[model samples]
Target: MSLFPIFLKLTGRPCVVIGAGRLAESKIESLRAAEAAITVIAPRAIDAIAERADAGELILRARPYVEGDLAGAFLVVAATDDPAVNRAVFAEATASGVLCNAVDDPPFCDFYFPSVVRRGDLQLAISTAGNSPALAQQLRKELNEQLPLDLGDWLADLGNLRREVVTAEPLNESRRLLLHQLAQRHVCAYDQCPSRLLAREHARTNPIPMEKA
Candidate 1:
């Protein structure tokens, strides 16, 4: 089946995780990395999860899963080893219209967590539609090795230039093409760089009319 890939903005969103073992701990950490407001439900939690709760990084409920646990959650993760409990969580999540991922149980999951490689603001995610997470992880490792560590920093510079160009230029095909060319050829916005010089020349020669500005 084809998947519609997306990057969610989970900052300040409410997310629920069921179970607190080693597996649950990983899911919780991934949610936390996205700055989601997380609540973990489990009768027993691993040391890492307990410590995080102690530090007020997340809300922890020292209890087993219960009905209504997923209410109002934007997303839910069922990370328990118990297949019954995972299915139960998935049912409630489906009824409530919340996205749910039952780790390792694709049939009960609304989504699967992709293996990710992150560098600053850049993220590369690999997914195999829950068929083979190991393969996704292997691909992530390979891409991580091939990509330059400084690529994110260079993208940041390109972003700044794009913003400036948008503000200073008008809507036109030349402007659009110039932006694409800049991305392909520019490293950073160093004034001495050939690409940067070309950008400066374009802006200077094709200034927006006074009325348009």
Candidate 2:
């Protein structure tokens, strides 16, 4: 992939948005999901954006874009109706070494937002490298339907069992196998899981607590 894909920790980090229209509202929502400290700049905004500001979800500048609005920002979104405004936000953000996305303008964007399927902590992101966002959204919809709604709960349970196996088994191979089996619990025939017995046997044989992940 030309673009390196990685999840970022943006919680409480400073972020700036240059618009408050519909497109900008979507961008702000994405930032809010990551718990970023967002500041929106626009003379007028849609009711949703204004409501968010009133709710203290984000700060509203109530003005047009300024030359140094991008300073001290970790990331910026330029989603104004004016192309010139978007480009200006990108230029300022770039000069200040901050990552910026100029909405639908690929050349002005440092990164593109992916179509995401979020199930608790499990997030699957799909991108077409800005070629077709509609296709990405379509795939996301399909995956959301196929993936089990309670998959996150199952994963959490499996995690607890895997940690127990790590403490119980002396050899890495045995622990690995036990963890692997626990992962395959969903495929167990009938109502009983054969791997649970094996995991317990190993724990009974070697009772040693270990560090947790």
Query: Candidate 2: lDDT of 35?
Result: 99
The true-versus-predicted C-alpha distance at residue 211 of model 2, in Å, is 12
**Top candidate by TM-score:** 1
Tens-place lDDT digits, model 2, residues 112-141: 999999877789999999989999999999
Judge candidate 1 at residue 118 and give its lDDT. Answer: 88
TM-score of each: 0.92, 0.85
Clash pairs (backbone) in predicted model 2: none
User: Lowest-lDDT window of 10 residues in candidate 2?
Assistant: 186-195
Which candidate gets the maximum lDDT versus the true structure? 1
Please identify model 2 stretches exceeding 4 Å from their true place. Answer: 163-171, 186-201, 207-213
Off by over 4 Å in 1: 189-195, 210-212
lDDT of each: 0.90, 0.86
Q: Give per-residue CA lDDT, model 1, range 102-135, as digits (tens).
A: 9888899888899999877889989998778889
lDDT measured at residue 122 in model 2 versus the true structure, 0 to 100:
83
